[model samples]
Target: MKVPARQALQMYCAHLREQAAGRASNGELDLVNERAGLAKAQRERIEMQNAVTRGELAPVTLIEEVLSKAGGKIAGILEGIPGAVKRRVPALSGDEIKNIGAEIARVRNIVASMSLADLRDSGAESDEDRGAGSDEVIDA
Candidate 1:
């Protein structure tokens, strides 16, 4: 039977407490406390997995916000280039300016095609790969 996350955790904690209290010899409570913590962690992990599967949880895109702010800064830099040319900066060649414009267009095309969900999925894959690496290190 499927029980709610909070209820399942609460029931497990109560059961653990009761069992521990019954078996305690005045100072053997640490082991029971550790068991309860482990159980709580497992329950919370399952709840998080369920919530993710049900689409009840979503990642907040602070990275997307930062990218937007960086885009604005890039635009300002691009705009300032024309002023630099006006001031006759010998370092700024026409071909170099054209290359910069082309690169910015390429970046825009790439960013426009990628949605937040796509980014999140890729991020999840990266996280999994990182976790797998850690597991390998531990096994070694």
Candidate 2:
């Protein structure tokens, strides 16, 4: 059976509310807001998945748009780090350069994993659409 978009949204909202309540109980306002933001993003993702399922949008289009925004963010992070490193040191030693390079590679790997997860989620949603029809939603 396919779940309606409204039901999915309600469930997601309820889940968010529960998380927020738990955080509040723990007296963690910062954590609550951070979790709320993540919940909001998840909600948006659900909507995007629905749009893809309904043939209202293409998955590739959404993926490319998201990746472009993520690329900009990654670029900004990369740009800012070099200036910070330079400000903290007169000049970087070869070893320091190598260490920084390794750190960058590690961060790049994390970014790549995140991107891959997004792609995998989109593909899974596409498969769900094929198997169960437009309203059939799965949490990716």
Candidate 3:
């Protein structure tokens, strides 16, 4: 229809002719495919960069760090509760506290093992996006 499209059609037709004559193999076609894939990948990277700049997306590590900090705060609160458990309930003694601690640890492990699949599925909202283009890796 357009000049560039017409030229590309002509070139493809020439390649097809060469193939029909057994003068050219699919190697050229494969190269073209690879180049198209590379171009697509590069375009995606640019679009992702732009999204980050606009605060529409954030880095994985940043999200991990935020989650880690929240987890740490929760752990601190949980740890404090064990000591208070004895004072709050006077009749609770001996291995009771220890058992409670063990159960808490077990529950924590189960919760920690829970899949984060739901988080990955959800769309990142506009207002909450932060830490654009930051590649900071969380050690957790």
* Candidate 3, 1-140: lDDT as tens digits: 56798899999999888777655647556555566789999999999999999999988999889989998888887777778998899799868888778667765765576558735745753322333344436698
Model 1 ranges off by over 4 Å: 1-74, 78-89, 121-140
lDDT scores in order: 0.68, 0.70, 0.74
After superposition on all CA atoms, how large is the RMSD of candidate 1? 18.0
Write down the worst ten-residue block by lDDT for model 3.
125-134
lDDT tens digits, residues 25-130, model 1? Answer: 3365566667788999999999999998998876668656888899778767765665566467668777767665665565555555767697777745544334
Query: What's the CA RMSD of model 3 in angstroms?
Result: 15.0
Please estimate how well model 1 matches the true structure, expressed as its whole-model Cα lDDT. 0.68
- Indicate whether candidate 1 or candidate 2 has the larger TM-score: 2
Order by lDDT, highest first: 3, 2, 1
TM-score for all predictions? 0.29, 0.33, 0.52
Q: State in Å the error of residue 102, model 1.
A: 0.6
Clashes of 3: 0
